[model samples]
Structures are given as structure tokens and as C-alpha cells.
Target: MEPVNDIAQLVVNGLMSGAILAVPAIAFSLIFAVLQVSNFSVAAHIALGAYAAYVVNTVLGLPIVAAVAIAFVAAGVVGVASDHLALKPLRRHGPITVAIASMALNLVLENMLRFGFGNTVQALNIPVYRDWVLGGLHIAPQQFYNFLIAAAVMVALFCLLAFTSIGKAMRAVADNPVLADIKGIDPEFISRLAVFIGMGLAGIGGVLIALDAAIEPTVGFRVILPIFAAAVLGGLGNVAGAVAGALLVGVAEELSLLVLPVAYRSAIGFFAIIIALLFFPRGILGKR
Candidate 1:
């Protein structure tokens, strides 16, 4: 591959990774949209999902679909449970307080995993295939598969939000909680539902990541910045924005390798956040 093609390949790879990141970004956006709280525990849920899928796929010898399902359920259940135990009461304290509490919750959950699973890294039991070369670009089979899965999840979520009655109610609550209440929507129910789905999506994202990398306690933390960057860049609380931000950040991070070392790639998210706050403020695509 020529220099141009190398850059092209990086962009392609970035897009693939970005798609995976979008799942958690949307998760964050969903929780924030409905509850107005920054539930950073999405990171721990990501790790939990990866570990859950690991148990199903590696230990139980189940298939990928089954593992994915297990990941979603486990992470989601923990999400709702943890919220009920720790963050629910703090909700009334405001977004900053809830966000701080969530950060603490994140450490607690992460430490719990470390204690139970230890610091060892684990990987999913799956077949690896050779990469396909297209126009001098290398596309890995696993990555393409992950991208497809992510796309499918996003489509399903959009359909739910656009077509389903519960989805509509959820959107109503996000749009205007008081008006939604006046219309007989149960805010509390919607909040739990959002956290369940949001954290579940985070788990799925972790599973996809684990397919390509090792599953460790910090799996979610490793990419949390990009996920958060994508959410903030897209406009906090804006689902569509999160997806867009993820893709853009993914591409930018890939392209960054052209100049900087791989160790610095994570810093891209911080720069993105600073840039968004400096100019976009409310986010590039978020409401005014």
C-alpha cells in the first residue's frame, strides 16, 4: 500500500472501531438524555459484559450469539441493580453529584471485577480468519463482523425509539419530563428502562472489543475516553450525535498514527472534548 492507501486503510479501520465505540456512546447518551445524569459506570458494565460473554463463550462453550445475549443481560441487570443500590438516591442531588457518584461507582464495580477475576487478561474463544485485501486495504473478517453487529444493534435501537410505544414514552420523558408526566408517562419506569438498555448496549460494545483485544478489568476504561468524547462531541444526550462523534473520533485516532505514536491515541478523546467545549459547547449536533 502506498502512503495514500495506508491512510485510507487507517480510516477504514478507524470507522470499524468507531462503530463499536458508538454502542457505548449511545448508551451514555441514553442514560444522560433520560436521567440527566452522567453514569460513568457504563465503563464497568462494559467490562462486565465482556467477562460475562467470556464465561458463556469460553467456559460454557456457547456460540457468539448466546454470548452476546448473556453479555447484554448480565451487564444490564447489574446496571439497574447498581443504580437502585447506589445512584438512585443521589439522582435528586443534580447531574454533577450523580456524575461524581457514578465515577465512584465505576471504581467500585471495576475493583469488584479485579477482585473476582484478578488482574489477568482473558480473550474470547473464537476462530480467527485472515484479513481480506481490497484495493490494497486490509480488512479483517472479525472487524467487519463486529461492524455489522454494531450496525444491526443501532438499527434495532432506532426502530424501537421511532416505532414502539414504550420507545415513544421514553423519548417523551427525555424531551420534557414534566409534560411526559402530565401525559401519564411513568418517569421512574422509563428511567430504569433507559439504564437497562443503555448499560446493555455498553456490554455489547465490550464484547465486540474483546473479540479483537483481551478482556480485562479496564477494557471499558481503555476506550471510555473515546466513548465519552463521542458522546460529548455528538452533543451530550443526543443519540445520533454519539454515533457521528464516534465515527469521527475513530477516524481521527487512526489517522493520528501518521504523526504520533500509538501510545498517544487515547489522548485524542481529551483533545476532542476540549475542542467541543471550546467551540461546540452544547455539542456539534446537540440542541441549542
Candidate 2:
């Protein structure tokens, strides 16, 4: 019974963590589906956003809310810049070239952070949002807030894709870029929007981590693999799939603590991915 209770607590923790993971996974799938290239620098972009927030809060003595806002805007701008400066120039070079460029840029950003921030790990020191007791669960305020925010964002994104003109245009571009170009959809502009949104998602994800705990300069480096796995499992370009995959991975990872040492908790994701690939190569929802 005690072990079972511990498993339950772990599941709660996983859900909390997975809620945050959904943001990046969704962004990854969004870009991969629409642009046909993995934004390998997603981790860097998110880290930069968190660092920007940290700077604003620490150096400028701004509130956490204000710092997050600034980070959000800055991250979006960086995403747009990536499309314009790197992906755009190589649009004719195919996704392989774009992915390579993204990876190169990621390296540049990671090194830049190391040079600027040094090797110290820093905590944001934001006050925890709230604490609530519901049923037998001890729920942190941030968990509820994050879950609500994630759900709202997902719903809003879904509506945007389902009912808006920009959404339709983006869909057209994703489906057939040449046709979209011939139809005057401006694939570059659409792609820029996707990149910006994707980066924004990554940025907010970082903020969530900062809000939840301490952040290190190299933190985002650890985020990429799991996020990609979640995204792939969710189905490429499928937002719903991303969210579902995140939840599943989070729960499984958390529950694994029942038998596995806590030290190897992070390794669970890798093991799960391997098992998932072997059994369901198309992932939980199938590739989009």
C-alpha cells in the first residue's frame, strides 16, 4: 500500500512535468509537420528565453510575470529570425540542409549562453502559485495553472488551425509548398509564423521550468531528446498526438520509480522510446 501510494505520487509529479513537456513537444511536431524540418535549436531557443527571463528578473529587478512576458517576446523574435536568417536562405536546399543549419545554430547559441552566463545554475525564485488539497492529492498551484494554460493554448491553437484563414494558408503550405507558392500563399511568411510560434512554445516551456524549480545554463540541453520522442510519438505535426504522448511518457516515467532507482529516472524515457519503437513504429497515434 505504501509503495502503491508512492507510485501515485510519482504519477502526479510526472503529470506536472509532462504538462510542461507538452509545450515543446507540440512545437516540435508543429514545425516538423509544417516546415518538414526539425528545429534542432528548439532547446537553445527555449533556454535563451529562460535566460532572458532570468536576466530581466535578476538584473532589472523585474517581477516574474514581467520577466516571462519579455522572454516570450524575445523568444518569438529569435524564432522569426531563425526562419529569416537560416531556414529561409536554404529553402531550396531541402530539409536535410535546413536541419543541419538548425543544429549548427543550436551549437552557436549553446556556446553563447555558456560564454555569457558561465557554468552556474540559477533558480528564478518565483513564488509558488498555490497549493490545493483535492481528494487525496496534494496539488501545487503551478501544476493547476500550467495544466489550465496548456489546455487553453492547445484549444486556441486547434481553433486557429480549424477555422482561421491563416490556419488554412499554413495548412496549404504544409501540404504542398509549390502549390501554396503558386497560389500566392507566401511559404516564407507562413514558415516564419510557424517558427515563431514553435519558438514561443519552447520559450514558455522554459519559463514553466524556471517557475517550477531552478534552471541551469545547460538545462535545455537535457530537454531536447525527450521532447522529440514525445513529439514523434504523438505523430508528426499532430498537436493532439504531442499532448497525448507527453502525458503517457510522463506517467510511465513517474510510475517507473516504483521499482527503478530514482537516480535512473531520466533514463526511463529513453527505454520507453525504444520499447515504443519496437512495438509501435508509427507511435501511439501514428505518424502524421
Which is the leading candidate under lDDT? Answer: 1
Best by TM-score: 1
Model 1: which ten-residue window has the lowest total lDDT?
A: 279-288
- lDDT of predicted model 1: 0.94
lDDT (CA) per prediction: 0.94, 0.79
Across 73-145, the per-residue lDDT of candidate 1 in tens digits comes to 9999999999999999987788899999999999999999999899998999999999999888899999999
lDDT of 2 by residue, 1-288 (tens): 766667777788788888888987888888887788877888887788788888888778898778767877788898888667767788689888988898888888778888989878887756666578665667898777777766766787788878999988988887788999999999878988888878887887787777776777667778887788787677667778888888888887788777788888788678757866788676788654
User: For model 2, how big is the CA root-mean-square deviation?
Assistant: 2.4
TM-score (all chains, Cα) for each model = 0.98, 0.89
For all predictions, the C-alpha RMSD in Å is 1.1, 2.4
Deviation in Å, model 2, residue 188 alpha carbon = 1.0
Look at candidate 1 and give me any clashing residue pairs: none
